[model samples]
Every structure is written in C-alpha cells, then in structure tokens.
Target: MCRGQTAQKSKRAKPYLDAENAEKMGEHLRSDYRDAVDFGGETGLRPGELCGLHANYVDRERGWMWVREVLVARRRVIRSFPKDEDVRAVPLTPKAIEILDRQLKGRNLTHGCGLEHTDGTECASALVFLSKRGRPMRPDGVGACVRLASKKAEVPAVSLYATRRGFATRAAEGGLDVFALADVMGHGDIRQSREYVQQTPTVRARVIAALGQAPPLTVIHGAAGASLGADRDQQPPSETGIEANENAC
Candidate 1:
C-alpha cells in the first residue's frame, strides 16, 4: 500500500488460486501474450524476467534459457534495469522453447518488445518479449495482462510472482518433491519455494477429505452406539493408508 497508491484493494476480493487456474487462463491470452504468460507461469518467471528476456537467452538446442537479468522498478513507469548478471539457466519445456523460438523469428529484429539487436554490439539488443510497439513493458502492463487473463478465466488474481508461486504449486500438486520443485522454481531460499507444497492438490484433497470424513471420526469418538457407529464407519474410506476403526466409537 505504500507505493503511494490511493485506492485500497477490496477486502472481499477473492484469494488467488495458484498455477492450475492460471494455466486454464493461459488459453485466453492473445497469442504473443499467451506464450509470454503461459511460459512465465510454467517456468515461474517474473515480469522483468519475461521483459528482459533476450534472443541469446534461449538455448533452443539445450532446451533451456539463461536468465541473466531482471528489470526491478521502484514504480511501474519509472524502472531500473536488469539486476541478475550471473545468467541463470532455466530449463525450457518444449512449449516454452517453442514460444521463444517463434517470437524471435516473427517479431521485429530491430525493436521487439522494447529490445533491439546489432551485429557485434557489446550486448545484442535482442529483447525476447516486447510490446507491439517494441518497447519494454512497465510492470503495470504485465499486471494488466495478468488481470485480463484472470478476468477471462474467472480465476484468482495473478501477478508475475504469482506465476512463480503457481509454478511451484502446480509442480508440487502434480507430484514433484520439495527438492525438485525448488530446483525448477529457483528459490535461493528453499523455504519460500517449499511453501507451495502445501497448496498441492494432494494436500488440498487430503485436508478436504479429512474434513469431510470427520463425522465418522466424531461418531467413533463419542458414540458407543454400535449401529450408529457402524453406519458412520461405512462412509467410503480413502484408498490410501487412512484407517477406520469402528471400535473407537
């Protein structure tokens, strides 16, 4: 709230769902934006990570992109430049690599998404993601894109970071272990990335199933009444190791 904004977000605004819903919304994006957003969501990249993307960043042969820079902004319009200089390589799923390859082939070589390239220049000006006008996007532009996507998909609000969260969440829900998910999501602090494990569909369903199954537990706990407890115990138990002992009643 301290970025000098006036209007506060509504308290009643719904919570954001992570990657699954975001992936669903990806279908609604305009082709370029769709690739960008979906790639971001799938790969767990931030807006600056997406915007600062360069042609050479993509290693199509290796099926990975070297993420070297990030555009950190004090504010949306007023922005600083890319900060991560060491160049981190992130694996590209086939779809992600395809998006980068196609964008490079299709868009302006001179200025695409606010980036350009020159032969033998100290740094190739090739920006991987660009606005139609060939300018780097402000954070607000990135946010708005997510908003439009959210509206279309009718899911929770998502941001650049949300993509990262979703990347971790979706992977965990899909059955990735903590170490694997952390590697994919690139969290320097394992704790941050590890948190997404709680959001996994497995975890959610377990919580829900546990809640839904609580009545039997209660019946077993309080009711010595044999018929009622037997009836209570008859509710479908999980295929997993969860045990049902009617005698607990």
Candidate 2:
C-alpha cells in the first residue's frame, strides 16, 4: 500500500471536458450534491481535499487557498508538511467559489433537518460537499459520483483527476515554468509531475498533425553485412605496403 503519499497515476495524459456535457451531468446528481462533478471537474482538487475543506481555507481576496489541511480521522487535519512536503496554493477562481458557496448553502438548508447520519455529522457539516444524509462526503464516493455524472454528461474518456492534471498541464504550457507549476501543485519534484501532464486528444492530435513530416529514422541495425546493399560493397583502401594486387612475394 502506498503510505503517506498521494496516489500515483499510471498515465499522465488527461482528457478534456466537453463543457456542454458537464453541465448536463449536473442534472443527474442528487439535488443537494449536484456540484460534486462540477467542483471536481473544475478545481483539479482531489475528492478528499474538497470534502476536507472549510471556508477558512479560502483566501479569496488573495485568490488562493491553503490545501495542506484535510477532513481526516473525523476532524480537520492540518499538516505542518505539505502533500508533497512543500507548501502550495491553488488559485481560487470565481467559478470555484460560486459552486462551493452553492453547495454549502444547499447543504446547510438540507441538513438543518436536525437529523444525523452515521457519523452524526450534519448533512450541512463543515464540509464543502455533503452526502445526502448531512455527513461529510467520502472522497472515493465523491469520485464515483463524478464518474457517474461524467457518463451522464456524455463526457467520454474523462475522470475526476482530469481537472487537476489539465490544470497543471495548461499552466505549464501557458509559460508557467515547471518549478512554478510544481509549487502550485504541492509537489517537491517536478519530475513526479508526469502524472499531471494533460495530453488531451486535441493536444495530441495537434502535435502529430503539426509534425507535418515523418520523424528521422535510425540505422537499420540487426542486418548481417553479407545482406547489405551494393552501396556497402565499397572496398577498404589497400595499404601502400601491399602493392595493389600482388600477393606478397
């Protein structure tokens, strides 16, 4: 089991959202949880990270959010260290805050029912997104919700992390250096960022079509000399001491 580390993604190439579909998926979500897919697909934040967040984490005026803390062990766990052992911040877009606010308000209105779920956590607890029963959401469960919505959204080849990886890749290509991107992603080694490179189909297709020509090929190795083309038959220069064709006296 991977311990104390974020999950490693086997492939880094992420898919892009066809926004129209994403919006459609919102309809499939339970009324109160509708924002789960939207927020996950927008923030590039992990499901756990989002569920773990509180309003305190947002520094809206500054346009960033502190992400080192989480709703773990049934309480907020703020790490002295970072997710990758380095401090990082995520820019807070108007869209992110908007959806978050809607979720919180909706949750509050729903959970005010004065009933409790398994954890006795109110449906409108301190979490950004809540389960139907007013309890903090499980990250895996959130991912499943998003995935299902994506399918309903008709967004093929997309997953929850696509947002996060897409964010990183877009940042990198937008002239944000690897170091800066790494910092924003809470990563220590930018190389570990292979997982965040968004090689969306559009990008990939453009790359190949832009090549416009075939790539250079290398030596045709593994062929025996006897089977080489006539061009390979040029004889080596005879030594001056050998008098051309005379087999020594």
Per-model TM values vs. the true structure: 0.63, 0.58
The lDDT per prediction is 0.54, 0.49
Write candidate 2's Cα lDDT for 43-142 as tens digits. Answer: 6565446666555456767877777555442222322233355545887678877876676563344223222233443444254565555555544444
Name the TM-score of candidate 1.
0.63
Q: Clash pairs of candidate 2?
A: 44-164, 122-134, 123-134
List model 1 lDDT by residue over 1-249, tens digit each: 231112114321213335467677776665666667777766777666776666766778978777766643222221223345334568888878777777777655543223222221354346676555444544445555666666677665455455655566667778888877666665666676556676444665578688874322311000111111123233443222111222110
Error of 2 at 152 (Å): 2.7
How displaced is residue 229 in candidate 2, in Å? 56
Question: Which stretches in model 2 have alpha-carbon errors above 4 Å?
Answer: 1-21, 72-85, 104-125, 169-175, 194-210, 213-249
